[model samples]
Every structure is written in structure tokens, then in C-alpha cells.
Target chain A: MTTNKSLFLIPKFITTPSQNGVGRYVCQLQRVVLKFCKNHGSSRGIREFIEYDLLNFANKNPEVVVYLKPRRHRGPVIKAEYLNGDDQIVFCHNNTREEIAKWLNLLRTQSGNHDGTRLRKLWHTDYPSIQGPWTPYTFRDPALNLAEFPNEELSRPLDQPKTATEELDELFKKQQESEVAESSEVK
Target chain B: MSVLKRVQQWATFARIWHVYDATWQNPFQSAELLKKYLMGIHKPIYHPMNDCGDHVIVINSLDIALPGNEWAKRVYFHHTGYPGGATWTLAWELHRKDPTMILKKAVYNSMDGNLQRRYTMERLHIFPDGNVPPELMGNVSNQIRQIRPMPKRLDHYTKEEVEKFPKIIDYPKDYILR
Candidate 1:
């Protein structure tokens, strides 16, 4: 289920393997949206789109459990702090918790719009590494607070598990050793 | 609290992609803006866990604008890694030589380390004219629902050329949802 009210459509530019391309594309794209919003009254048009969609959906059926594919605990990506070898760093977020809280508060406080989304029922749309057999995390953020962003642990040090290639190499080595032993026994 | 929410959840898991575009004073500025638009950071939907950006289509690559004499002065570097294998070309050379690859290459340079972004970028379409060929139009791609930058007939570029750029041609607004 989804609502037009506040689904943050962050365009993760994973189209090209080249890092420069992603940045270049993002930069150009930002300008366009800025221009569009400027020409079309920017956020106002967006607000209108949201109101129209929500009202339309509500009219059809009052019960709407819209699942938003939003960013995880949108906060600051602070360099991980390792405390007593108990470093709890996770994914690297762009903003810190304070910044996120500030933005959320600011967006919510503004009476100009259809009541900002305000982190309503958060969900983390996972993007993983290419070589990774991505480990699945639960959709429901148990620690999520409607008024608050996720804790600073948003930027976690990605302690990657055994990679696919590494695992394959290990398997190959074991097989090779077994074959060698069998040959030696036969000889 | 039913098993069906899982089914509903499964049904709801959309393969949602992003779409971004820009019309610059010139291709340089256009490509610059287009880069940011496709990256999804511009949108509120950005997620670190998942790269949430969409498929971007950059029209009007030929007319990209550059600051000052960047077109003439800006040089792109390439390394062969063999003695004196390094080569360089000015931005002007690239645009004229291929034109299509200039903006694409510019963007490629910007996205340095993100390997996943490399895949999501396949959705991007860069055309010199507003009227791109039919194949480039978003209508054909099931993932691309609408053509943003709304397909205008830029100066001298034909409507046909614009249509060619989008995956869909003569598509109704409701075509994708239907």
C-alpha cells in the first residue's frame, strides 16, 4: 500500500557502474526538478499532487494501509565512533540524527502544506553491493518513533560476511584437496 | 494481522524506478542538472539501504551549455597505464566526435565508486534533440511509465526525433497503469 502524501522517491542512480556518471546524473537531475518546481510553484504543486491522490484514494476506500518505500532513518552519515571496541556503526547515512530531526521538525511545523509526512511508519528500501548475497533485515523498524528519526547508528560500518567469490574459492580449494588425496591413495 | 498482508505486501512490492530530466540553456548545464535529477538524492525517497533512484532520460544533449570556454579548455583524461599511454581530449572534441557520449561520459566521471549505480543507469537515455527516436521513448519500457521533461519540440528538433527518444510513441497518459 502506498500514499502520495509522502513517499520520498530518492533516485538511487545505480544504472551505470561508473561512480562519476551517477554523480553527474544526480547533479543534472537536481537542476531539472528545481527548475520544474520553480516553474510550477515547486513544492506547492507537489502538495497538490499529494492531496489529490490521498483524497482520491480515501474516497474510494477509507481503509488504506499504504506502505511507503522510503529511506532508512534519514539522518546524518557521521563517521562511525568505535567505543571500547563496541563499534555499532551500520549503514552510512548522508545526514546526522540532529539534522534529520531538524528537517522533520521544520517540515512538520510549516502550516503551509498537507501536514508533512513526519516519518510515518518508516521502511528501509535496501540497496546492496553487487558481490553481496544481501542479508535481509526486517522491514518493520522496531525502534522507529513517529516523531523521531532513527538513532545515530544509521551509519554502521558494513562488516560484510563471506563474499560469494571468497566462498566459491574456499569450496574449490576443498574439492581440489579431496581430489589430490584420492589420487595419492590410488597411486 | 493476517497472512494476506504478506500477500498484500508481496503484491505491493513494486519495482519502482526513478525518472529525471532537464532542459538546460545548453547541453553542459543540461547534463549537469540531469546527473543530480537521476540520482534520487534530489527526491525525498532517497535510501542508503537501497539505491532508490529511477531511470533517467536526458534530452537535448547536443545543446548542453558550458561555463566560459569549458568546451574548448576542459580536457578529459584517459590512462592506458603503459609508458606515456595517457591521452586527453577537450570537451569540445568529445561533443563533436560522438556528441551522444559526451554527457554520458561526463556523468560517468561523476559517479566514481558506486558500482550499483552503474546498473540503474541503464535506464538513462541521452538524445541530442527533443524528438528522440521511438525506441528511446519510455512508452515501450514497462518500467518507464511517463516521459518527464514532457517531450517538447526543442528548437529545430522534430517531433519525430523526440518520439524516437522515448520508449513509447503516441502513448496515452493512462497507458502504463492500464
Candidate 2:
């Protein structure tokens, strides 16, 4: 089969924004810069978000510094600077107040690190195993070490898949054997 | 268990080093344990779909223990995708062929069949013995406790130490000499 061509394979990790920290989390978003126009039709949603939701968001996340810049005739844009020295710019031309809020929330929650195209792993940790990792010799029966391979007993499957009817028949046979043994003991 | 503690846990993520010693431990249990790390089940942020697991370094693959007659009974099946190209290798034979294959297969089989399984397996570092490469040494942060204690070899003990070890009984003078 032919493999498809791809632009990237591995994901990229950022500097400061991390989800797997050592029992501590540092707020990654350092500051947010919002640029909007005073009388532009496209800037209406951003203006509404600023007027209504911005104050609450700022109050809730006191760690994040929020700045509002009003330009003469520019379209609205939101620029977020992360602690990792990366800046994410979201164009907000003709977006709604709810959409702006959603975008702002996304930026706030992000660790500022982007996994480029292919992620090597989803999770990363320092302490991987608590008990231990398994290996081939972990639970090996000592008999196998000394015995030769392809031996009669070991060469067969460890367990044969038994059906319910077979199990009942075995039980009946065991009961008959026990009863016969008791009768012989009485004699 | 408190709400405040829960909130703090939700906010903070800790990366810990885990080491798994494969000496004399069952391969099945080892696979189960590694699956936890591969699937990120050991972490608080573990979601079935999320990659939030830690790295696992397994040592002593050559000395790993297997239960029952699995050495000969267990078979690892493979296909070449060609006509009459199926192959079945016995567990012991596979181990002798490649010491790490048994453990790798066990851990691999334990994982859910998905694209993410490949990503999870990447975090697992396996070694046949104590000799770890320099590059992988940096990735290891902490060691997980051994499931089974390392069996002490007779050569490892000093003469005095072996003599000092308590004896079950002493031969009586009256007892018949061989």
C-alpha cells in the first residue's frame, strides 16, 4: 500500500505553557490585547463583549492582564501573549459577543503549546510505574526453565475452551465417582 | 476528597518518574500495569481519549518470569498478508529469538486497538538488562516500586553474612553419618 504525504509528523511543545507540571500550574496567558474600531459595523460583537463580558472575565482571572485598544478605522482583533513567549492572534471581524467570549475562554485555558501535526503521546509524566513494569520472565514457572522446548505437556495449550454442556457432564461424572467410592467403603 | 483539594488537583499536574523492574515478575501482571500508564489510567486527568499518561522504563526483560507452561504453550501469531504465510512462534522461542518481544507483545495486546495505542507505546522504554543507554537515562525521573523483590544471588553475599544467616537446624552427633 502507498502511504500518503504529510506536511508534519511530530507535535510541537511550548516553553512555559504545560499541563503536566510538578503539582503546580502556572497561568500561561500573560496578557490579552483587544483592538477594535469605534464605529465599524464589524466591530459591534467585540464592542458588546468588551462592554458586558470583559469586566467579569478580567475579574475572574485577575492573573491575566487585559488591554483594550480602539483604533480609528481598524477591524477588531484579539491578540493573546502567553508566558511561553508565543502570541496567538484571533481575527474578530464580524464575530458575535458569545463567539468572542468563547475565543477568550479558549485562549485563557490553553497552555500556549501547540502539538504541531502528529502527537507522539497524549500524556507525559515523570513517575510512570508504581509497582513495576512486566517483562517476559516476570511470572515464569521455574519448570519451564529446566524443561526442553516442544515437550508434550507444555507444547499443548494451557487451557482448552470448555463449553457449558461439557462442564455439566464432568460434574455428573465426578458425583458418580464419589457415590461409587462411598458404596465400596460401606462394603 | 474535599472540594478545595479537588479544585487544586484539577489545576495542577505533576510529572513523576516511574521505573518498572521486570525481574521475576509475571508478564501478564506487567502488561496490565504498563497498560495503566499507556492508557493514562494512573493519572487523575485520565480520560479514555486523552493522552495524559507518564513514561515507563522497564528493566530486566531477560529475567522476566512467565506463569505455567506458557513458555511452550503460548503462541504469538503473525501474518505476512500473503497466501499460506501465517506464522506461529512459541513464547519461549520468541523470547530466545528476541528477549524483549514477549513483554512487548503482552503490553501491546493489553492496549486497546486504536491509533492512539501507537502513541502510548512510544512512552514505554524496555531494556533486556540493567544497561540503559545515555539518551534514555535523562527521560527517567522516578522509579516505581518493584512488584517482586530481586532474588539475591549466593555470590552477592559475603562469607560472614551467609554464616550469620539463621540456620533451620544443626546435625546431632548421634545422628548417623553418611
- For this target, which candidate reaches the highest DockQ against the unseen true structure? 2
Expressed as tens digits, the lDDT of each residue in B86-107 for candidate 2 is 9999998999999888998889
Model 1 CA RMSD to the hidden true structure, in angstroms: 32.2
lDDT assessment of candidate 2: 0.75
lDDT of 1 by residue, B31-66 (tens): 454555556554444565555454565555676566
Residue-wise C-alpha lDDT for candidate 1, range A57-154, written one tens digit per residue? 33443232222222233322211111112112222233333443343333322222222234433443344334433111224344432312111232
TM-score of candidate 2 chain B vs. the reference? 0.83
lDDT of 2 at B155: 86
Residues A1-187 of candidate 2 have per-residue lDDT tens digits of 7665455565542333344365886778889999999999999999999999999999999999999999978999999998878888999999999999999999988877353445566665555667444332345467655653213343232345665545665776687799999999999
- What is the DockQ (computed on Cα atoms) for candidate 2? 0.02
DockQ per model, Cα: 0.01, 0.02
Against the reference, the lDDT scores of all candidates come to 0.44, 0.75
Model 2 chain A is weakest, by summed lDDT over 10 consecutive residues, at A148-157
